[model samples]
Every structure is written in structure tokens, then in C-alpha cells.
Target: MSEKSKNEPFGDLMKSMNQFFHEKPVKNILQSMDDFFKNPFPNSASFHVELKEKDENYVITAELPGINREQIQLDVINNYVKITVKQLNIFTTEDENQQITKKQQSFQQSTRTVPLPHHINEKKVKATYENGLLTIKVPKEKGKRISLDGNE
Candidate 1:
């Protein structure tokens, strides 16, 4: 009976019914679902690393927690040192009914590739893990020592 909606299909009656149900708009609902999937999920990111030059050697340190030595890997490819780490998380929940639920998740690895200032001696490289920290030592290639005495 409203004059504003007098020519509308099913007119004022449908408008009043819509207000009663208080249904959410389609766009708003879709946006909320979109935001839910965009965040609140675990992801893989690079680990923090520190590189230092020690005379004829390069010292690399990385912070790795909640992981074992077996899960870590290192490789020298080209002129870069590739460091990879794999991590696994276990979650458990229980209620008052003495029921238990366990969930295991395998996350993507965190890696870092560092290039050395000079060519490294692959045979003399060394790495060690201690207290959640990974340390690597890369020795530089020895240069030929030439004596300048005007001697052929």
C-alpha cells in the first residue's frame, strides 16, 4: 500500500517481508568468506640468517628451532650455499568426555641461499648444529702467492 513502491512487483508486501527476515546481503557474506581464506593459515617463509666474513673463511649462522639435525640439509650449488629445513607440527585436543583428537601438520620448508664473496673450497666446508642454531664455515680458494724479485 506504500506509494513509493506502488508500481513495484509484489509491491510493499514483499518489501515489508524482506525487512522482517533481516537477511544479510550477498556481497557482505561473500566478502567475509573471502577474508577467512586469505589469512589464518600457516605458510612457509625464509629463515633468518647471518653471514660474516672471517679472514679467509665465511661464517654463516641461522636460527632454527623445533627441528632436528636430520630434518636439515645443506648443499653447495654453483657459487651459492643452499640451506633447507623441514618442520612438522603435532596438535592434540581433548574434551571432558575423555575423548582425544590429534592432528598432524607438515609445513613447507624454510630455506635460504647465500652466495659467497669468492669461490669456496667445497672439500673443506664444515657445518655444525647446536642448540637450534646452524653454523657453516666455507673456506675461500687459496690464491697463488707470487714473489716479486724480478726473477723469471
Candidate 2:
């Protein structure tokens, strides 16, 4: 019997329901759900990496836990080094007849690209993996100094 809502003919009841949804807590929950759906798999926003410069080469070490060497890919393109890791898991439940009743599959992948200060020879790059750590060594390209004073 309250005043009718201008936006809806369902009267004050619908207006009250709509007001409930505008509460701060409810809005925050809805916003979180919206963000999650927008990017369901927000993986590796901050992958760990370390870089060191030596006299003749550069060394890079990355921490990649619970990952196997076969699941990792490394590439030296231009003056940058790209590292990618991918893991896949499959689970299934079988009955006495060996028929899968429930099956699930999950896939995850992360990638990090690091820029080098100097040009490197990709052919001479060396990489090794041990104990969830990856180390890469890249030799710097020799530079020839040019004299500007007309001197050889």
C-alpha cells in the first residue's frame, strides 16, 4: 500500500529489494565476482627473477617451483630472454567396470620475459635447470670502438 515506484510497477516492494542490492557489502561482492570472471586465470603476475652481470656474460636465475624441466621453454630473441612454464593435470574417477564417472582437467601456464643490457649471441647461450631453479648464461657480443678523431 506504499507509494508506487516510478521505475517499476511492482510498487515499493521491488524498490526496497533493489535498494538492498546497492548496499556497500553487496556491491563489493558483486564487483569481486565481476573481476574474477573478467580474468578467470590471473596467473603469475609477479614471477620471481634475478639478474647478474659479469665481465663477459650475464647470468639469470628464476624460481619455478613444482615444475619439471620438460614443461619449461626458453628462448633468446634479440636482446630479450623469454621463459614459459606450462602444467596440465587430469583427474578421473572410474567404477568397477573401468568406466570414468567423473573427469576433470586443469591447465596452467606462466611466462616472463627479461631484457638484457647488451646484445648477445643466441647460439652461445647456455641454460640449466636444477632443484626448481633455472640458470641462464649469455655471452655478450664484442663491440668495436670507433674513433671519432680520424684515428684508426
Top candidate when judged by lDDT against the true structure: 2
Give the per-residue lDDT of model 1 (tens digit) for 56-138: 78899999876799989999876789899977666767778867865567576777999986666677899999999999999
Write down the worst ten-residue block by lDDT for model 2: 1-10
Cα lDDT of model 2 by residue, 25-141, tens digit: 998998989999977657643358899989888999999877899999998788999998888999999999999999999987788898997666788999999999999998877
**What is candidate 1's CA lDDT for residue 99?**
79
Identify the runs in model 2 with alpha carbons over 4 angstroms from their true place: 1-46, 150-152
Worst 10 residues of 1 by lDDT: 38-47
The clash numbers for all candidates, in the given order, read: 0, 0
Residue 151, model 2, lDDT: 55
